[model samples]
Target chain A: MRYFLELAYRGTHYHGWQRQPNGISVQEVLENALSTILREPTALVGSGRTDTGVHAGQQFAHFDTDLTLPDTLIRSLNGMTPSDIAVYDCFPVAPDDHARFTATYRYYQYQLCRRKDPFRADLAYQFVFPLDVPRMNEAAALLLKHTDFESFSKVKTDVKTFNCRIDVAYWEQHPNGDLTFHVRADRFLRGMVRALVGTLLAVGQGRLSVADFGSIIDARDRKRAGRAAPAEGLSLVGVGYPDSVFTQRTTGPAQAF
Target chain B: MRYFLELAYRGTHYHGWQRQPNGISVQEVLENALSTILREPTALVGSGRTDTGVHAGQQFAHFDTDLTLPDTLIRSLNGMTPSDIAVYDCFPVAPDDHARFTATYRYYQYQLCRRKDPFRADLAYQFVFPLDVPRMNEAAALLLKHTDFESFSKVKTDVKTFNCRIDVAYWEQHPNGDLTFHVRADRFLRGMVRALVGTLLAVGQGRLSVADFGSIIDARDRKRAGRAAPAEGLSLVGVGYPDSVFTQRTTGPAQAF
Candidate 1:
């Protein structure tokens, strides 16, 4: 049997999402907790990996088991893990379900604050200066028309190709003067979101012109892009899956919990 | 001679604002950097100690030095420190000037975000559920009416006294849907802001009534308060000082910085 789990974790404590020898990781902890509950060793496949100190609002993982178990695996696994790590959904999925490959889109967000908000200093990047949001947005519109993002892709990434269909990308300001950059893409190259953010920020700071931004994308050269923003300022907000992956009421009103 | 210097530190990665042998601390690293620059052993007296992962927006400290250095020490010191920490103001004060004793008010702000703002996850406590702001504000008003906040003070704190005058206390909602509780008092017992935030969250969560919040303050027992909110959720927003504490204006215009 195969199952999918919807989860979230604080990335600060983990080196990244993957397992490592020197330190405990989010995946290792989850696997240990879930396997203990299932009474079997399980290697869960995660939607993707996030860098150290990078957080996730929503992530998905899949695991297969030969024995039958009740649907309360989420509740049971949660009881075994720390509060910072949470497992909210657990249900059997189709045999062909792939946590990563089958995902429709992945969403990411970055936060920028003008003042160093004491309560949010760790989470939000405090720029302490005005930004050119209009120019950044005009640059953002360029993302929707492109598919190959070699310029924004990290060099030395293990990704097979530097191709991504960015469905949406835009920058919006919140009332508190906090700025948010939301991006959705069919698939993201390693460090893609952070690189895009860094490039956009150059536009925000007025250091890069929109015309230059468009040309950089056209160059298809990693050296042409700006620096990737720090991992702490980025998050893997969510991944969308087709309704057929899991058999729950696809779009019905489920308990909000 | 002794000089009081107002500064701020990003407490992320630091065990706390104080020196500690177990791990890296803001004070220890800062003192080392300053001592290396000043070419003398340096010890600083901060307004108070902040726990590990806590932040200070405007913290005051006094350091004694036998060597005479120009006010440019501020710029030089900041240049040597990392980006996370900086000296916003540096001034020489009277021999009797003290950072802690002369402080008239210490204002703290507790920030809460409704959505999982990846940008603010480290800086704000993200709670998805709606908070009852009006009830929380009412409870905050009740707090302003009291001098003794034994209910909110952390137990086992080494403060000489728990009684303090709260001149300002209230909760306000920002446009980004982040809630901030601004509190100003003559002084705060250790962990008081986090404790108050936890207590107010109980009211906001509808677990405790607004009336019960009033009674909680009157109880004057640490156990009466709710659990202390996470350390990252609270920030030392500002600290007030008398005009005598500031150095004479060397330049023409007078700015807060």
Candidate 2:
């Protein structure tokens, strides 16, 4: 049977979501813990790979197991996982359900603090200078109108495609002087969100004109883009799937949990 | 010559502001770094000891040196200190000046987050439920009206006294659904702010009556206090000294190398 796990974690301690030989990854730890609990070898695939120090508001992964587990699968996983990692929900899925490919869109949020608050030192990326949120939103809106994101793609990545349809792109201000950039797309290229944030920040700081941002996307040249922002500010917020594919899928009660 | 250094540091990676044997400390690292740069043995005395994972928004320390360094002391110190530790302003002070004793007051901020934003995992302690800010403020107001804070004092601590005059006590909402408890006092006992936040949180959660909070302060017994909040939510925001101390002290501009 196939099962989907809704998860979230503080990525500061792990190497990333993908498995690696040298450092501990979230995937490896979850797989090891699940194998012990189910008493069977299991292979799990995450919906996305978050870089080291990148967080996730909501992340999903799927695995297959022959053992019959209790209905409260999430409770057992939550009890076994480290305090930094939490499993919020788990349920059996259709045998063909895919956590990654079947998703229609994935959303991400990048949090930025404009002041030097000591409490946000390790969490939100602290940028001392003032920001132009309106200009940033304009640049982000232009991003949603484009499809080929080659300029924002990491040059050395092994991904086969650089195309993505961004359905939503905008910036919202929190009362605490934090600016959150929300961007949702059918898919994202490797390092795409971070790179876009870097370019948008350039526009926000008046370094790059919004008109120039459009050409950068049209150029589809990685060298034309600005450097990627640090990973600490990025987070996977939500994932959306086609209604047909996710007919029975529903989030558990979000009323304070 | 005797010198006093005004510095700020993000203490997330540090064991504490003081030298420690368990792991690398902020003071030890600064000592080693400054010693290596100046090629002299330096033993600096700080205003106070900040516990592990506790940040210093404004910290002061004094060091004596037999050799004469450049007048641009901030530049020299910044060149020596790590990125996590920053030296802002430095000046020559009277040999009798004491960082801890000469201080008139010390201010601390305890932050409480109502929700997990994926951006505050390391920087702020995430409290799930909403807190009644106005009630907590009323209880905190009672704290400033009293001198004995035994209910907010940590147990089994080596302190000469638990008496303190709170100059300011208030909790302000930062619009990010996080509350900041700002308190200014002549001095704070060990774990005082965390303990105070614990009790105030209890009041906010309906665990303790707001009217009864005053009696808890008068009780002065550690057993009457609530559990200390996590260290991540606490930060030393400011340290105030007599104006006369900084009057004669001349320092150079802040220029980080």
Candidate 3:
């Protein structure tokens, strides 16, 4: 049977979401816990990889096991996992369900705060400059017009193509003078969201005109784009999946367990 | 001149808000940074002291210095301080202004989340048990009826009296299945808010009744009350003072600096 593991992690301490040889990773921690609990070598196929210092509100992974999972599996996994990682739920899924390829849409948000908030210091980027929200939104709207984001993608990435279908892209301003850029796409290239946010911020600051941003996208050169925003400010907010893939969906009543 | 420094800190690292003989404290770090920047030994009188692992959203401290402060003091202090500590603003205040004694009210919040969230791992306490919000509120309302909360105060405290006037006490529920307890009072004894939250949580869990909570307060003995909630879930949200204390209140335009 195949099981889907819904999880979340603060990537500040780990190298990244994927398994790495140099340092500890969220996947390694989860895999170790799974192996210990199942009494066998276990591996996970994660939905996508998040870079170092990038947080996730919700993430999904898939693993296979021949035995039935105990009712207390989630609690046991959470007990074994580090405090920075949380296992929300584990439920049965179709054997063909793929955590990576079956994902329909991905939502990401990058936070920038003008005021210094000690609580959000690690979660948000402290930007001193005032952002022109309207201007930033105008620049963000341009993203939906184009599918090829070669200029925003990191160089030497292993992805097959730079094409991605952007569903929604906009900048939202909060009451506390914080700006958040929300973007949803079918798929994302390495470092694409952060690069787009950084370049759009330049437009908000009036350093780059909207026309210049358009030209940079047309250039298809990573060097033409601004620097990628810091990873700490970025979060994978949601991953959309088809309803048919989940064999069981556990909601509110599960908390009572 | 006396300067009021508004700051905030994530108390996960240091030994709470006050200077201690053993571990490093937020006050000690701030004092060191101030002394280094001003080239004089400076000590701060904080609005209140938070226990270890307790966060502060907005806290005030006062210190005296003879030299004129540069406009870059906030930026310099932030540069010297750790990432967990943020110096929001520094402004001149009246000589008689006191950070601790003159405060009109203090606001504290305790956060509890049923769902596991990695983003809020350090910010909130995770409890999988279902909470009866209405029952918790019923018990919270009883707090406003009494002034001497000897049951909530930590043992062997140096305070002359256990009296406290609770202005507001309520439990707020969020859409994401998180509950936050907000309490405002003229003053708080050491471990008062945490103990109250813990006892209220017991009432919500049906381990104790609302009447039992009132009896616990009437007992006026710390040993009779529930255990104090963990420090990580509690935060000092705000400290209020009179308008006469400030010589100048800096607001939005300071962001440009």
Candidate 4:
């Protein structure tokens, strides 16, 4: 049987979403907790990888097991996991449903703090300079018109193509004077979201014009883009999956015990 | 001359606001930072003390210094302090101005999470059970009618009186479905806010009626109230002082260098 686990994590303590030899990762911790609760060696695959210090508001993982699952699995797993990580739900899914490949869309957010906030020091990027938000929005609209994002992708990524269908991309100024960049797309290349935010910030700072931003996208070279924004300010906010994958919706609300 | 420093801190890492014999405290950190920057042994007094694991959005402290004030003191102090603590302003005040005695009002907020949130694991108190906000507010209004809070105060305290002038007390529900208890008063008893919140939560959960809450206050006994709510959910959000204290306001916008 295949099961899908819904979870969220504050990524400050982990190396990233994927397992690594040098430092602990969210995947390793989740796997250990699941294995301990089930009394068997369990391995699961995450929906995608998030960089170090990046948070995930919603993430999915899938695991295969032969033993009958316990009714107290969720509670037991939560007890075994650290406070920074939480498992909200566990439900059966079709054997063919893949956590990574079956997802239809991904949504991400980048937080920018206009003022120095001690509470959000680790959760947002502080940029005190005055920003031209309307001008930044005009440049962000240029994202939806482009299909190939090679210029905004990491240079050494292993993906086969740099083409991504962007559905939504805009910057919203919050009432507290902070800024949040909301972007949704069919898929994303390595380091794409942060790169886009960095470039848009340049536009907001009047360092680059809308025409210059569009020309950089047309250039199709990663070197033409600005530096990648810090990982702490980025979060994987949501992911979309098909309804056919679920045999039955048995998960509860996203709350910790 | 005496100077007033406006600051904020995330109290998860500190023992409490006051210096302790065993653990690190916010007061100790600030004093050390001041001593390092001024190159003299400097000791400051805080507006009030916050329990361990509590947060402060805005706090004030007054320190006496004989040496000429440095222009880069704010930046230097921030550099010496950790990321969780922030100093927003430092200005000369009247020599007689005291951080604790002269303040006219103090405002506090207690956060309650309706659902389990991974991002706010340490910042809010999670109560999955249903709550009656209107009922809680009604119980809170009873607070403003009373002057003595001995029933909600810690038994062993150095204070001579338990009477507090409550200006405002109310519970507000945010759009995200979280509840916040806002209270402002001329003074507060040790553990008073948490005790009030815990007992009011009982009213919200139907465990106690509004009249029962009032009777708890009228009893004037410490054992009559519910257990004090956990410290993590509470924050000292604001403090009000008279306008006569400032010699010259020379503070910039609150932003970390």
Candidate 5:
């Protein structure tokens, strides 16, 4: 049976979402915990990969198992896994319903602290310079008009295409005067969101004009974009899937076995 | 001259606010950072000590120094100190003004998570069981009527008195259903906040009635209270001092040296 897991993780300690040899990854720890609880070797496929020090407010994963799952799986999984990761829900999905390929959209947020906040030191990028929020928003609107994001993508990525339909892109000022860049798209290329944030920040700082930002997209070269923002300030905030994917919920009610 | 340093810290890595031989502490780290930046050995006396794993949103400390201080001291101190600790402001105070003894009140907050939150793993205490917030507030209101909090204090402490003037004590439920216990008092006994939270939690859970809680305080014995809540949930959120303490603001405006 195939089951989908809804989870979240603080990615400060993980080497992204994928399994890697050098450092521990969220996928590795989660797989180990699931396998132990299920008493079977379980492998998980995540909705997408998040780089080191990036956080995920919501993420989905799919795993296959042959045994009848316990009703207390969620509670047990939470208890067994480290505190940085939390498994919120688990339910059977259609065997063909893929965690990655079937997702319709992804939303990401990049947080920039206007002041040095000790509580948010690890969670936000500290940028104390005065910013032109109105000007930044003007440049951000340019993102939704462009489909070829090669200029904002990491160089040498394996993806076949750099085209993405950006649905929303804007900078919102929080009550605390911090800024958060909200971007939603059909799909994002590796390092695309951070690169976009970095470039937008340049515009906000008056280092780059709105016309200059538009020209950079037309250039279609990664070198034309600004540096990728730090990973700690970026988070995978949301993932969208078709309603049919969750129509076949099969997990039992939560109860102690 | 005596200067007061306003600071904050995330205490996950430190032993506590006090210097200890066994482990690192916030005070030790701050002192080292100050000593290095000022080019002289310095000592700091904090408003009060926070236990290991307890966070502080706002704390004040006094240090005596003879040399002229730099205008960029706040910025420089922040740059040199660890990310977990931050010095917000520094200004000379009346020589008689003390960080601990001259303080007017202290405010603390205890965060209880209604559900497991990956982002707040180390910042809050997770208690998934259902709670009665109104009942808990009723019990909390009784705190203001009493002066002696011996039942909610650590058994073995060198404090001259256990009497506290609790001005505010209540449980507020956030939009997400998490409960925060906010308490303000003239002074707190050792382990007083955590012990009060634990006993209040018992009231919230219906294990102890509001009348029973009042009786516990009247008993004036530590054994009558519930177990002390974990340190992670408690934070020294605010410290109050007389207005005259800041009348001699001596720190210059923040500027790059």
Candidate 6:
């Protein structure tokens, strides 16, 4: 039977979400713990790969096993995994359910701190410049107009198209003067969200106008876009799947051990 | 000139706030950075020490220097310090100003998560237990009634007295089901706040009644109280001092700089 595993991890120490030939990755850590706990070798297919130093508020993966999952499986896996990685839940899924392809929507948040914050240094990008939120949002609306985002996509990739359905794009200014960019789409390219954020920031800084941003998107050239923002500020905040695929609550309610 | 520096640090990497014999400490790091930036030897007297794995939202220390204070001191010190240690501000103070003795209030916050949260795993303690908030508050209210808290003090301390003036004590539950305990006092003994939290949690769990908690304090024995909560969950949130000693704002207002 196939099982879906919901998890979250701080990607600072890991090379990335996917297994790598050189450095350790989140997948290797999860698989090692799952295998050790189950007494059998295990393989996990993640919903998507997050770059090194990025973080995930929520992520999903899938693995198959013949043994019935014990009640203590999640707890045991958490104990074996490193402190930065947390496995929240594991439940059965349909045989053909794909952790990656079955996801309908993806949400990402990029944190930008205007001032120096010791607590947020690892989790946010410290940009010490004034930003025009309204102007940035004006440029944000232009993102949904174009289906092809080659200007924001990574230069080297093996993909048939640079098309993605962007449902939401906006900028929020927090009370602490920090800024957060919220972006939701059906899918994203290799470096799409970071690139988009970088370009929008330029617009907010008055370096580029909304019309210039639109023209850059229409150019369909990576060189026309702004530099990709730092990876540490980006996080995969949410992933949506069909209701039928989730057989049980992703996690149980609070209770005493 | 004597300068009071307001700073914050994530204590996950250092041994603690004070200089230690063997391991690296926050004080050592700050001193090194300040000396390097100022091009002279320096010593800092912190308001107090924090244990290993504990965090500080706002902490203060005083240092003396013969050189004229520069406008770029904050930025230069920040560049010299590690990312986890943030120098927010530095200003001149009265000759006899004390960072520890003159402070009238210190506030601490203890975060307890009812469910698993990967983002907060390092920042909070995951207590998978149902807590009776009202009962915990009842126990918390009892904290301000007494001053001699010898029951919660670490045994080997060299302090003259265990008396503390607790100004505020309360437990607040967030919408996400997380519980946070806020405690403000004129002074605190080593391990006192964590010990109070642990004992109150026992009261919430029904292991100890509110009356039992009061008795534990009355006993004045180190073993009477529950075990001190983990260090990671506790943080020094704020420190208050006389208006006369503060020549400038301890922290600056929110701005995009």
Off by over 4 Å in 3: A252-257, B252-257
Docking class of 2: incorrect
* Total colliding residue pairs, candidate 3: 0
TM per prediction: 0.69, 0.71, 0.94, 0.90, 0.94, 0.94
Q: What lDDT does the true structure give each of the candidates?
A: 0.78, 0.80, 0.89, 0.89, 0.89, 0.88
State the iRMSD of every prediction, in order shown.
7.0, 6.3, 3.8, 3.3, 5.6, 3.9
Who is ahead in TM-score, 1 or 6? 6
Provide the lDDT at B127 for model 4.
83
Model 3, TM vs. native: 0.94
lDDT of 2 at B43: 81
Look at candidate 2 and give me any clashing residue pairs.
B150-B220
TM-score, candidate number 5: 0.94
Where's the lowest-lDDT run of ten residues in candidate 4 chain A?
A248-257
Q: What value does DockQ give for candidate 4?
A: 0.49
lDDT of 3 at B42: 96
Worst 10 residues of 6 chain B by lDDT: B248-257
Local accuracy of candidate 4 as per-residue lDDT tens digits, A108-166 = 99999875677877788988799999999999999889999999988898888899999
- Tens digit of lDDT per residue, candidate 4, span B11-104? 8999989999999999999999899888999998999999999999889999999999899888788778887888889999988899999999
lDDT of 6: 0.88
| lDDT of predicted model 1 | 0.78
lDDT of 2 at B85: 78
DockQ values per model:
0.09, 0.11, 0.52, 0.49, 0.49, 0.54
Model 2 lDDT, residue A99, Cα: 89
Residues B111-202, model 3: lDDT tens digits: 99786767677789988787889999999999999999999999979999999999899999987779999999999999999999999999
